[model samples]
Structure formats: C-alpha cells, structure tokens
Target: MNKFLLTFKDSKIEKDYQENKLNTLQKPIFYWLLVMSFTLNLLKVILDYTYYTVNNQSWMNVGFVILVILELFLACYKKQYIKYALIISNLSAGLLQINFDESNTFPQEYYSYGSYYAMLSVVVYFMTDFPYSVFQVFIHLSMKIFFTTIKSHRIDMLGIILGLITNVFLVLTLYICDWNSRRQFLLNLREVRWEESLPFIIKKPFYLFTYKDKNMSFQVNRAYNQDFFPYYNQEDCCGCNFRQFLRKCKVENNNLEIYLFDKRNEKLDFDLVYQNKTHKFDIRVCAIGLDQINYLIILEKLKLLTTSYIPKQTNLRQKIFQIKKTQIKYQHQKHFLLGVFSMFLYNNKEITSINLVDVLQKFSSRYFIISKSKIHIVYSDRSIYQLITYKHQLIIYLIQLFDCLINNQADPHSGIKLLLNQGLYAIRLKIYLTNRLKFQEQYKDNFFIQEIERNILSEEIDERLEISFLKKVRSAETSI
Candidate 1:
C-alpha cells in the first residue's frame, strides 16, 4: 500500500530527494533514455511521413516532435527542468498516440501508447526524488482510466487497468531496490557535503549536534568530530544546551548548561575549548521538523590566520627600526657587535632573525675573532666570553653594529653581511641563552635544533676561537 501510494516511504530517501542527490549511475542511464526518446520520436516522424502528410497533420507532428526534442536537449544540460520535460513529453506523446490507431487498443497500446504512466514511472525512478513522481504517476493513471472508461462507454477498460497494475508493480520493485541505493547515496553525499568547508563542514569540524525529541531531550548526530571538537565521547551524549559535552569533558566555562530547546539563529557566536586551545565557532541551528531542530557547530581555524590586521599609518618594520632615542641608551658605548651569523647585539640586547642570537653584556675593545668574516660573540653574566681580535675593519664593523642596535642615527647596513639563527636552525651562543624563556617556547622543535646547537657553524669556531676561549676561561678562573 505504501509503495503504491508513496514511492519513497523511507525518511532517508525523502531527505536525499530534497537534497537532489542523483547517483553517478543514474546520469548515463538518463542521458541514454533522452537520446532514445529523441531518436524514437524522429524515427516515427520519418516512418509515418506519408500518413501524416496525407492527413495534412505533418506540421502538427513536426512541431510536437520538435518540442520533445527541444525539451530533451534542455534536459540533457539543465537538470532542474527535467521533471517538467519528462511530464510534458509523456503526456503529449501518449495523447497524440491515442488517435493513431484508435481501433487497435490493447494492454500494450491502450487505445495507442505503450503504457505512458509505466514509462513515466521508470524515468521517475531514475530521478533524485519520489513524492512528485508518485503524485504525477497517480494522477496520470487516474486520468487514463477515466478517459478510457468514458470513450469505451463501459467501466471495463481492463487493458488500462492492467497498465496501472504494471506501473504499481514496477514502483514496488524500485522502492525495494531504493532501500540500498538511498543508503549508499546518503553516505556518499554526506562525505561530499562536509568534506568540501566553512560554508561546507571542511575547515570547521562539527563541535556539537542537538535535535529536539520529546522522548529524549535531544539526540546527538555527531560525526567522529574528535579532530576539530575539543570534547570526545564514546557514546551518544544528548542533553540541554550546546556545550553539555564541555561539562562532561570537565570544561568549567559557564553557559555550558546546553540548551535542549531549539534556537533560531543561523550565525550565533559560540566558543570551543579543545587541545587547550580556545576556538570560536558559528552555531548553525537548522530545524528539521516543527519540534525538531539540529544544531551544528563548526570550528573555523582559518579565522585566526586570516584575521584582519589593524592598519597602521606607519609600517611595522619602520616602527621597529625607529626606536625612541631616549629608550635606546646609546651613551656612546664602544661595545663589540658580533657580526657573524646574522646576529644583532645591543650592549647585548634583543635580536630576531629567520640564526644564532649572541647576547653579550658590557665589555670594551674586546677582540672577538671567529674569522675575518665571522664575529661570534656569546657572552652572559653567568658565562662571559671575551674576544681578542686584531682585525681593524672587523673592529670598525662591530663598533658601528653595536651603535646600530641602540642609536636612531646608526647605520643598519654598516657594509656587512649577516645570518641569525632560527633555532629553527637552534645553535648556541651560550648554555644560559639556550634556557631563556623566549627559546624555551620553541625548544620542542625538530631534532635538528639540538644537533645544530651542539655544533654552531663548524668553521666559525676554529683555531682562533679555541685559543681565545681558552685564554678567557683561564683569566676568569684566576679572577674568581
């Protein structure tokens, strides 16, 4: 009874229909049917050319066939107009055939068309929907039966009755087959839907899901959302409000009461805490039924990376370089600026690059020699490295660089090449420097950091540095 009346009794099938999910297999079959329709209509016109012309109905057949051909052409490209094309073609062709051989009416050619309703049902079966198709089938069958009875002047249009039975049987067979087809289609469609987004569910993973049900406060129809969602449950965790799972995961943020009732906001701001990172999401409340609403929260990770930067009148690089002279404290200090490894030294202050940062404390006329080109200075209050370099140009470069770190008028170019450590690339200026808070943040980088740190530029610390380092350590020990 259900199949006869409603072709798709399954809720999922109905949903797939609403979503317009045509399976891959359906396309080739539909196109083939369209071609077959065009060819058959054209062939009939060609074969019955004499007959139509003799009756002076040649233009009528030509125009009617052209309409079907035009409709089929449109249907091949534009899917939305297909149902109308199918309906129009089926009815028009059937009605035209009615007078063709009115005397020779049979079950196969019921006064004269090959079960138009049955053919319509077959095409409908290939479509993405069923309710409209079923209604159309019912109306068509009913009209055919009524017309047949009126023309025959008897209630026994048993041939049309047989056609109706064939259509119903065909629908029943399709309904049964649709059980699996709908399931596969839904699974594939769902993956495609979420797998594609922020507008889709790709970038933002589902944080929470709630649908209203009187028996159950709500139902959780969550995907395996552990990747984006902070909270993970082994079971269906339904409750009031959206963040009920947050409480279960021991998240202490307030408003975690989780509303069981449906809310009507398409884009409400929501927050999530997963992997100890706080994320903001858009709450999409989609009501499925009058009492049933589905809440899907997705975490937009890109919002952070793509956040609009506050436009400033001055650029960042220019502002950073333009330090206030008052804050600089240049004080005409003749400090050694280690010019090796792209490192910037203030009387040993802050430096950042894409290399080793050698921060040194107060010292004067220090001879720091890595090479004629290398200025490796790693000095601290705890572990001080003293340099003794005799190079005149190196001395000038160091003095100029030290001034550059603090003074506004100091030249950054100073006619020298530089390389700083990425730690990324983390090498050692000193053990104390390695343990600093700034370095600790990225201490967990690749294994290359520890390797690079163990060996800071093999050629930079050669014979000159070894001798200088030895002498300084000895002097420090004696002073201590």
Candidate 2:
C-alpha cells in the first residue's frame, strides 16, 4: 500500500533516475511535449474559427498563438532550463484560461472540461516524478477551487467532489505505472552490468588493490592512465575501482587486452588525471594468503611520499630486508658434542632447493643438511667450505632440553653452549671440534692437489654440457 502511495520506496532509485536517466530522456521528452502542445493549439484554432469565438476570450486566443510559436522555437533550443521554463509557463497559462471563463464553457461543460483532463494527462506524462507532479497538481487544483468560489460567490461541493475523484484516479494510475516500469529497467540494467564485469573479476586483480605502499609489487598495466578519459559520461571515477584500473591500463599485444603482471616485491608508480587534477599513486603487490595476491594503491596526498622516492626506494628496500643479528645461548650439563668436516666436492656442483637431496647424495658419507642460505655461511674452529657440525643433529637434541630436568643433573643447563644466528636460523655457530673427512697425517701439499683435480673434472663436465650454440644459450639463462 505504501509502495503504491509512494511511487518509489527507495530514495536511491529516485536519485538514480535523476542522475542517470533525466539527461538521457530530456531532449525526447521536450520534443514530445512540443508536438502535443502544437497539436492541441492547432485543434483549438480550428474550433474557434469554425464554431464560435467568445468576445471576452479573443485576447487569450491571440496570446495562445504567440505562445505556440514560442514553444516551436523552444523545441529547437538546446538548453534544458529554457525549455523547462517554457513548459511550466504554458501549463500555467492553459490552467488559467480554463479557470477564468464562463461557468458553462469551462467549469461545468464537457468540452472545456475535456481540455482540462488533456492538460493534466500531459503534465503527468511529462513530469514523471511522483511527489513533484502531485505537488504541482495540488497547487493547480486549489487555485481552480478558489477561482470557482470567487466567480460563483459560493462553494460548489458537487463540482469539487468530482474534480478530486478524477485527480486521485488519474495521478495514481499513471505515475505508479511509469515509475514501476523504470524501476524494473534499472534493476535489469544493474544485473547486466554485473554479468559484463564477471570475466575480468575472475582473476585476483580487484580484491587486493591499494595505493602507496613501499612493498607494492603485483602488476603494472602497460602504461597505466596514459590517456585522458572524459569526465561527464556518468563516470564517478575513482582509483578504488581495481578492475577498471586494470582495464584502463590494458594493451593489445598479439591478441586482446593483455596486461603486464610483475610478481616481484616492489612498488609501482601509477598516475591518473581526474577532474583536471593529477593524482600520483603508489601500489604494492603483497600476498593475501598462500594462493592469492593483493595490490595496494595509496594516494600520495594521504601517504606523503616525495619525488625522490624512486631512486631512494632501492636503498630503502635493502634496509627493510637487512637481516638483524639475533643471539641465543643455551647451556646444558649433559655432554654436548660438536663436529666439523671439510668436504671437497666438484667445483661446478651448486647446491639449490631443487637438487639439495641429489647433490648431498654425491657426497661419500651421508651428510644430512640442517639448513643453508645463499647469502649466509657457517664458521667453525676446524674448517669451512662445507662445515659439518651439531647444527644438523636435530633428532638427537630435539627432546634433550626438557629431558635434562627429569634426569636431575646438578646443572643440566650449565656447560654445553648452544649457538644461534637470526640471519640464518640454527645454522651459523662457533664451536671447537676435530675436523672429519680430513687426514691430519697428510701434508697441506696433498690436500691442495686433491682440490685441483676436482676443479679440472668439473670443467670437463661443463664443456660436455655446452655442445652447441643453442645449448650454450639455454644453459646461460634458462628463462630466455
């Protein structure tokens, strides 16, 4: 019941119609209004010349002719404000012409009263806004009643009752029907817009988009916001629209809409000009979970990054990632052991995550890896260049710390010192031990000769692998 009484239940829908639909429908509605008013005036001219012309209303007929010509001129006018002013004036004049006449011609008879109904129907159709249309009608209806009482010097109850009933039925039916139709159209349009956007949103672009973080490195669309987009295409454009940002940054390589996706941990500069003002943004590509990544775009005004951020960002990134030293010491009375072994492997053999187990297999003894880092190495009292220590002895010492308390030693936490390094976890430690896999009896000259033989053998393997030009290129850079 409330929905019918009020054409639109939501104020947002009314706002949408005004903001979106009004400009689109403006010219067409104006043209239609012009045609209808022209036709009605033409019909009135024929009636006046053929039938009878009232002596008192002669000035009104001449005024109607001038107004019709003005309406025709307004139909060609481009400005909406001018066209609207003309429409309101014309409607007001038509209402006054009907009201200030003799009782038989306009107030009581079917012919003049029929024109009254025609005028109202045009008002309802032209001004589809329910509340405004009803407001206009209320003012007109009250004015007509006041005119009737003034002319007859009495209140005509029957006539007012008839006028009220006709108005209620006419305004409600036409306005509600029109609003409902437009409402459904808007709803269908919204659904279609979602369906169109689904393809781009399938990827992880929209969710993690933010601006102005130093750690932003997800993607760089070919040249983001290199072109100017027009402002008044109903576009309330903002940087928050991640999919639109991606689309705007798109370029066509060999196929359709290809975007540059950079997975490095870095910040990308994205510039956009909106509403005649330039905006500088910083975007960070960071991982949301293990599987998906988010791009953060921060506005420069909010975050306050200077112009020299680009050159200094490298040094800044290094500072962010610079490993801080962490020291941890544990002492146990239980006999703790430490050992270091100097192993000579083939020079060309590189230990990596993929071939770790495989390369360890190449060694003569079973060398279990505690851990290793590309930028970090271990140091011990005996030897380095593959140092073996209690660092790999996880299984033996796993439960010994807590179990020492159960054994009730005098000071289980005192003698044996456990070493720790924050840069390389549980790996780099200082300890005293005898070196294994090294013959102490052998002279230093003998150990040097063994290292030379391993180097020559590894070089021979490399020569065998690089047989052709294609093989050399492929081996030099696997990514190429």
Candidate 3:
C-alpha cells in the first residue's frame, strides 16, 4: 500500500510538471501567432492597395478588400484568434497568383510586388508548426520569380539573383532562430522533468557518512551513491573538516550508536555493505532505517539550490486575508455614505458604461490599505466586476451569496433573510454535503434562522444598491 501511494504521488507530480511546461509553451506560441497574423493581414491590405493603384486592376483589389472584411469579422467572432488568422492567411495566399504574360500589362513584378509576398512568407514561417510554412514559402517565391522572368521575355537575371539571395537569407535566419528556440525549450523541459523525479530519489537510502574528532571538533565525510549521482567520487580524501562540533549519533531499530575518535584521521575505518559484498573505505559509515535523515539533508540542499531559480509566491492564506480586508473596507466606506455614492455613479445608467476599472481605481485609492489585493465581482448577467480587497472573508461571503442566488432562492435586497427563511432546509442540506456531517447534528434546531439574520446584516450592499440606483435615476445614461 505504501509503495502504491508513493507511485501515485510520483505520477501526480509528473503530471503537474508536464502541465506547467505545456502552459509555459502555450502563451509564447499564442502571442507569436497572434502578432504574426496581425502583421501579415495589415501588410496584405497595404500590398493589395498598392498593387491596385500601380496596375489599375480591380479584380484582385476587390477580392482583397472582401478578404480584409471577412478577416475582421472572423477575428471578432471567433474566440481562437490565432486559428482564424491561420485560416485567413491560407485562404488569401491560395487565391493569389501572378500573371506571367507581358501582354496582360499587369504582370506581378518580382522586386516591387514579390517583396511584400516574401514578407508574408516570413510571417508564415514563424506562425506555422512545421515544414508547411517552409514548403509554402519556397513554392510561392519560386513561382513569383519564374513568372517575372517569363513576362519580361528574358532571363531577368537581376530580379532572379536578388530573389534567390533574399530567399536564402530569410530561410537561413528563420531556421537558426527556430533551432535555438526549440533547443532552449527542450532544456527547460529537461530541468522540469528532473525536478519532478527528485522526490523518488529522496525516498531511498542513497548516502553514507563518517565523522572524526580532533581538538574538540569533528570532520565529517559523506558519500552519496545513486544512479542519478554523477559527482559521487569528487570529495578529496572522502572527508570535510569542521570545528565547534561534538560526536555524531543516529538511532536504528530503537538503538542509538555514537562514534568518538581521538584524531580526525581515526574515523576512516568503516565499510559499506551492499549487494552481499562489503566495500571498505578510508572513512565510511553505514546507516539503516534512516530515511527521514536522508530526506531532511536532501531537502535542505534542494532548498538552497532552488532559492535563486524559483520565484517566491504568496501563500493562499495571505491572499484570502488581503481580499477579505479590502472587502471590509469597501463595506465600511459604502455604509458611511449610505450607498449614495454607488447610486450616484451607477444611477439609471447602462451597466456596460459603468467603467468597472475606473471604479476599482477610485476604490483602491480611497481605501489605501486594501490596494494590493485582487478583487473579482461576478454578476448573474454574465458580467464580471472586479476590485482589490485586503481579506478573503468578503470573497467567501460573496461566494456564499452567489451560490444562493444561483439556486434561485435568495432575494438580492434582503439576501440572507430570504435565504434563511426560505432556504433553511436547503442550506442545512448543503452543509451536510459540504461538511460531511449529519444535518441534524450540526444545525441542532432553528440555528438556520439565526444564521440567516446574521448573514443578511453582513452581506455586501454593492449589487442590489447598484441595480436600484440604475433603475431610479433615468438621466445618468452610459454607453454600452
């Protein structure tokens, strides 16, 4: 059972490590594609306009204009902006072709027109996943150069040479950048994998040590052996000098053993027993059932090594406390003004125009103490409001209130009162499920009534007050 639990724990850690790596990659890929696509579309529009002005061609111009409108609509309509960008660019490029007949009087010029296409090729290089962009750029540029030479009715050696040189340089640069990016990404992944695997090593007996004394001090020598340890034999003479130290001791199977030596070199007479063989060393010590000791030592070393590599994170308890404090401050300020200020701000105005950010900024500045906390407000109408608070209590209270509202039993005006009076049995039912306790034992009797009254008095007044204010004053209109 213990082995199974350890395996499960290891699997969980591995899963978390993989998830973090994936998340890290996701943001960079997303932004790279987004910026690349946006730039490409802008460039396409410019090129299309310039081409039409230069060649007096209306068909390509019309087609490009329609594509631009479609791209805009697609960007706004789809939540996956990068995917839309990919689709739009692919569609536009697939339809674009250069005429090679000089008689047409509007054949695509290699340098003047193909340069923009080359720029688009670079964008595609960065945005695409693999050889798709590479092959596409190669084909597109080659075809453009071929058509330009054919239309000029000559080799067009200058244009061909320039095009070849530019394509070579662009492809080489992109290849190097991609290789370096992928190499760095893999290195980071290896580090994450190593960290996730370290716990397994800590769970086993992987180190041996000995201690020697000289002049009321001791010198300790420790040897670590594991499949993962690469620097096991680097210690000189297998010992380290220390002072102001006493004898070293450990307990095994409820028995304690202490080592005392007259000189620092005297403690070098021990052996490590492994695989049914004894390996004698100058200063060797064997430990049995000392898993906890090894774990502590490994943990201490890991803590020191990772201090500079890992970022410091705020504890969840601290975050909750800060959010609660901010909520309380907002409550007090609202109470002092009797909800008049909120009413004045949101009175008969479109909720969309209320400028949630501006309100949060003002609130944060006014209640300076809670300025550091993050606040989020969720409305039933799919609108999210946010503020920063200093404590988690307010968030907890709001979450409970929101839960009741979601279940369709709590009135916003007198939230806790309505919930207690009508939802007492329901609240008790929830408490039983949440606390894993019998409803009869926790509520005892009629305790729900008192809870409702207490909660009603403490519930924040922002939502109901804002709605009422919006309904009453008709002149303070805001735009959506």
lDDT of 2 by residue, 286-319 (tens): 3332223234332222121123222244443353
Off by over 4 Å in 2: 1-16, 19-26, 39-56, 71-76, 82-90, 93-116, 119-126, 165-175, 178-182, 201-480
Say which candidate scores most in lDDT. Answer: 1
Please rank every candidate by TM-score, starting with the best: 1, 2, 3
Candidate 3 lDDT by residue in tens digits, 332-362: 3333232222222211213223333344335
Query: How many clashing pairs does model 1 include?
Result: 19
CA-RMSD of model 1: 19.3
Off by over 4 Å in 3: 1-55, 68-117, 161-173, 203-480
* TM-score comparison, 2 vs 3, better candidate: 2
- Looking at candidate 1, the ten consecutive residues that score lowest on lDDT are 471-480
lDDT tens digits by residue: candidate 1, 101-177: 44433555552355554555566554634555555566666766777677778887567768689779865666666
Error of 3 at 294 (Å): 21
Q: After superposition, how far is residue 450 of candidate 3 from its true place, in Å?
A: 42
Number of the top TM-score candidate: 1
